[model samples]
Target: MLRSPKDPLSFDSREKIALFIDGANLYGTAKTLGFDIDYRRLLEEFKSRGYLLRAYYYTALVEDQEYSSIRPLIDWLDYNGYKVVTKPVKEFVDQTGRRKVKGNMDIELAVDAMEAVEHVDHFVLFSGDGDFRSLVEAIQRRGRKVSVVSTLTTQPPMIADDLRRQADHFIELAHLESRIGRDPGERAARAAERQDRFARDADPEDI
Candidate 1:
């Protein structure tokens, strides 16, 4: 069973904390809020909260595509403070002969969280997937406080009731928007610059 923290935890330089982000889930949530995540700001926000030992981001990439909409964000996160874990998205033919996209990082995230539990005082998870309820239970058993960062604002609730009830604390993502949301004008200016550069340095195959 999961239990709530008795008190708000403090971030001493010695308090070990690790962040495990479910990339697709987090991206979906952020997209719903109409903004790109400023990973740098995300890192700084947590670093100020505790001794951040690691920040892991997990995503499945659709390889063999000419271009992926999420490629740039993945690249940016890789070069930044995040330790990005990516695997090629698997495509399978279903019984109905329909193609299905198969890419879930739940197992991977759980494994990492379990491995890091002993090393960290606090574990922060950026996902609302119900599959993680057991993972949270296991982490809590290790005596490490686990905080689930998702939202209850969306219809049907973005967080699973079981998971929320099990966590040491629940942090609604809406509360962190001001700390992580990218400025619209700044994003627009960057996009415009990229378009201009693409036009100027076009290759025959690049188009």
Candidate 2:
């Protein structure tokens, strides 16, 4: 399934592959597809492709919250197969006194990718941010095949044109959903329970 315009299919198994996951980017894509990812399946899917050396997940957390929405997902990934990297999102007031959230993991992702370039044979990035074009180019310069994963189904699509063009292979997120999507019956049951909870907590007028 790993066809490329660059190299032939004669590459060996020791050709190490690494996954650089942009947490927010991947979350948004999955949310758009209406399913949660089965991380175990995702890992197995890639392991079948080649030697998987590492899977790195990067995200910024909102500090000082009583509870964060992403906490459970982060914990799950940490215990699973991923190398979870997180940093607290900084809150600052701009010159106009508007509160702003600053949490960009581009530098961290780039550094890790560069460090792994020496040993990795393939790089798979789970983001569509155009800023990574240069980083992808750097990896390609080292003769590693770079695969970019993001959706092409949305109105404007999630991937940047230049990034898609630069990658050796561009895998759309939709194609991967079947392998990671939750069962529809289970999803409906969960939604019904959530709605029931909301109804029990609210006045009839509020509904």
Best by TM-score: 1
The total of clashing pairs for model 1 equals 0
Residues 1-207, model 1: lDDT tens digits: 213233223345667889999998988887776677888998998898878999999998776877888888889988888899888886788999998888788888888889888899988899999899999899888888888888777887778899899888888777677877788899889989999998889996878
Candidate 1: TM-score? 0.85
Q: Which ten contiguous residues of candidate 1 have the minimum total lDDT?
A: 1-10
lDDT of 1: 0.84
TM-score of each prediction: 0.85, 0.81
Clashing pairs in 2: none
Model 2 root-mean-square deviation = 4.6
Question: Candidate 1 at 3: error in angstroms?
Answer: 17
What TM-score, to 2 decimals, does candidate 2 have?
0.81
Cα deviation of 12, candidate 1, in Å:
5.9
Candidate 2 wrong stretches, greater than 4 Å: 1-14, 92-100, 188-207
- Which regions in candidate 1 have their CA more than 4 angstroms from the true location? 1-14, 92-99, 201-207
